[model samples]
Target: MNKMVKGRIYTLIGAIGWGLSGACGQYLMNDSAVSPIYLTALRMIIAGVFLTILAFFKQPEQFKTLISTPKEMFQILYFGIFGLMLCQLTYLIAIHDSNAGTATVLQYTCPILIVIYVSLKEKTAPTVMEFAAIFFALVGTFVIATHGNPFNLSLTPAGLFWGIISAFTYALYTLLPGKLIYRWGSLIVTGLGLLSGGILFYIGSASWQYTIQWKPYTFIAFIGIIGIGTIFAYTLYLEGVSLIGPVQGSLLASAEPISSVFFSIILLGEVFQGIDIVGIVLILIAVYLITMKEQLQEKHMRIKH
Candidate 1:
């Protein structure tokens, strides 16, 4: 297969993995006995360990280079704490407060946030398509939150708040690691970041104190969260981005919300109103528009050249 086809497949697999992880997170959280903090800590640690080992085997020199300098160490630590830790924590909290589908949709605002940040950094106005995308994102979010009723909210305030925060942190995650990723390779950087973040989470949460009843499903869920969700998902998604560029990769990742909503409705029996579905569709369209705009701009530049 061509790189584009492989990239799309990888992107789709990554999206499905994340979508499944969100739903599984909700499932685990519903157990009442499972603490979200503890779960997040454990998941990060397990995935970090796995990835670190993989990175060491795959690219030992790059892994060594990543940790060689204090500046690089600090960068990895910062990326871990702010980028990986906060992003995952807020996302899990959002899922705990609301359904997986809603949480995923809210996190879709990251693209919009990225656009805004780039505009501010570059001191340029957004393109017309970008403006339209922003409008659609806002209106879609409003629809999802309010469910077409101005007075009442479909999602809890905490859910909405955390979800937005998740998106913001995700945007930071995307932007903060570009230099390190370029220099040290994405696998090494991500592995180290996850490991550092996981250590911090362990210290902060004192996760060892959390007690849990051992169930088969609990173990399975933990494995799924760590292995498929974090390790495979991040690895595959980054590979896809490298192969096809971020715009097409992101467009393919729209499958995340679709998978999340589908699994939530099917596996968890979550119900969505017509308005909610419409809201989800609009948000997805907004994401597509934003990504497509970039694709078009790239094409136009190529044509001009």
Candidate 2:
């Protein structure tokens, strides 16, 4: 297969896994007696354990090397605590304060934030198209959040605050991994970061109201989705960022909302209105334009060089 085709396939698989995992999480929140905080903590711990074991058995040398460096240790801690723990915890809390769809969209604002972050780090202003994309995204988000009536918004102040916090923290998380991945290999960075995050998650989970019911399907789904779905989804998405480039990767990752909407319809039986459909399209277009802006800049650099 061509690179484009491979990228699409990988992206689609990652998006599906990630999109479905969100649904799975929402289900647990609704069906089980688990607190969102506890559930997020347990999920991270379990997934982190599996990842740590995989690294230990499969690539002990690399894992050892990753741990040996102080810088690497900091990276792991940063990702585990700030990136993973903060993002998940804040996002779940945001969802509790608001709707899941709204929370998801808010968290996705990370990609746009990333574009700005990358540009600022490079000490360059974004191009016109990039601004246009940002504009569309902002407008689309407003429409979705306010239900097409931006003037008369109904979002709770607490929910809005938490949701934006989730967005900012997650954007930081996404940016931090790239730096770590550059120093260590993706697998090692991912494994160590996850393990660290998992530790934090365990501590958080411990403080919450916890109950364990041995439902076979629930346990299986948790393992299957949280273990494989979440882990592999992130790993592959990061790999895509490495292989294709973050601009393209972010565009692909932006498809998360589409997949989320899809699963929400199929799994949650959520009704979609015409306005929702339009919002989805606008968001997609905005994401595409924003992420592609990097490519445009690179092309210009190449011409000048």
Candidate 3:
């Protein structure tokens, strides 16, 4: 396949992988005695080790650059703390405080945050379509959070807080790594960031006396699947971003919640009402609008020029 086809395939795989993460988390929470915090922490650590080893072997030169530059070192540390650690901690906290579906929907707010961040950075106003997309996404989030009941705001305040924070952290995560990837390549930067995050999680686990159980193929497989799956997803995601630009990449990634919804229905037996379906449709339309803004704007500019 050509680069475009390859990029789309990668994007789809990444979306599916990310959507499965919630199911995996819920499975671990239900089937095992692991706390979300401990599980997330372990995930960070183990994935870090796995990726670190891979990076060392495959991209030795990039690894050397990472070790050589103080700025690059700081990038790893920053991403580790903010991107990996904060993202996992808050996201898991959201899941614990609320249902996985609710947390997942709230996390989708990251795209809105990303649009705002980019708009601010560029000192340019967002197009009307972008605003419409943000509005649709916000509406979808509200519907999902309320479970279509407008009066049920008291279900999970803590979960909502953490979920919102997780969204912001994710926005930063999306924005921060582009420059680093340009400088050091995806493998080295991602590997180091994972290592730093894992170390921090290890410290947290140590403090809490979180013991790892070595029984049950389910638990063992869960860890490996989540870790390796994420690595594959991230690798593809970075490549897609590089090929297609972040705006299009993020729009493609917004399909993640669709996958999550499908998995939730199949695996967890969660059913969507008519209202929920409508909300999801709106969200999809909104994402399309937001992503197409640049193309639309470029067309208008060409007409004017």
Per-candidate TM-scores read: 0.95, 0.85, 0.85
- Would you list the clashing residue pairs of candidate 2? 80-197
What lDDT tens digits, residue by residue, belong to model 1 across residues 1-305?
99989988998899888898888788888753677788888887888888888889999887787677889989998998889888888999999999899999999989999999999999999999999999999999999999888899889999999999999999988889989988888878888888888999899889999887666587677656677878899889878878988778888899999999998998789999999999999899899999999899889999999
Q: State model 1's lDDT.
A: 0.88
**Displacement of the residue 182 alpha carbon in candidate 2, Å:** 0.4
Best by TM-score: 1
lDDT of 3 by residue, 1-305 (tens): 88887887787778777777776665566555557777776777767777778888888887876788897798787888778777877776776676556566677778678888888989998777778888998887776557667789634778768878888887777677878878777767777888887787678567367554444655644743365457666777767766765656767887777877776677767666777677667767776786688667667988999
Model 3: residues >4 Å from true position, as ranges? 118-124, 147-149, 205-208, 211-217, 220-225, 240-245, 295-305
Q: Extract clashing residue pairs from model 1.
A: none
**Quality of model 3 by C-alpha lDDT:** 0.73
Error of 3 at 105 (Å): 2.5
lDDT for each residue of candidate 2 in 143-248, tens digit (9 for 90 to 100): 6667688676656777778877898899877777877777666666666777788776677557455775545457755754586568778666655665676556
RMSD of each: 1.6, 3.0, 3.2
**Which 10 consecutive residues of model 2 have the lowest summed lDDT?**
212-221
Model 2, C-alpha of 146: deviation from truth (Å): 1.2
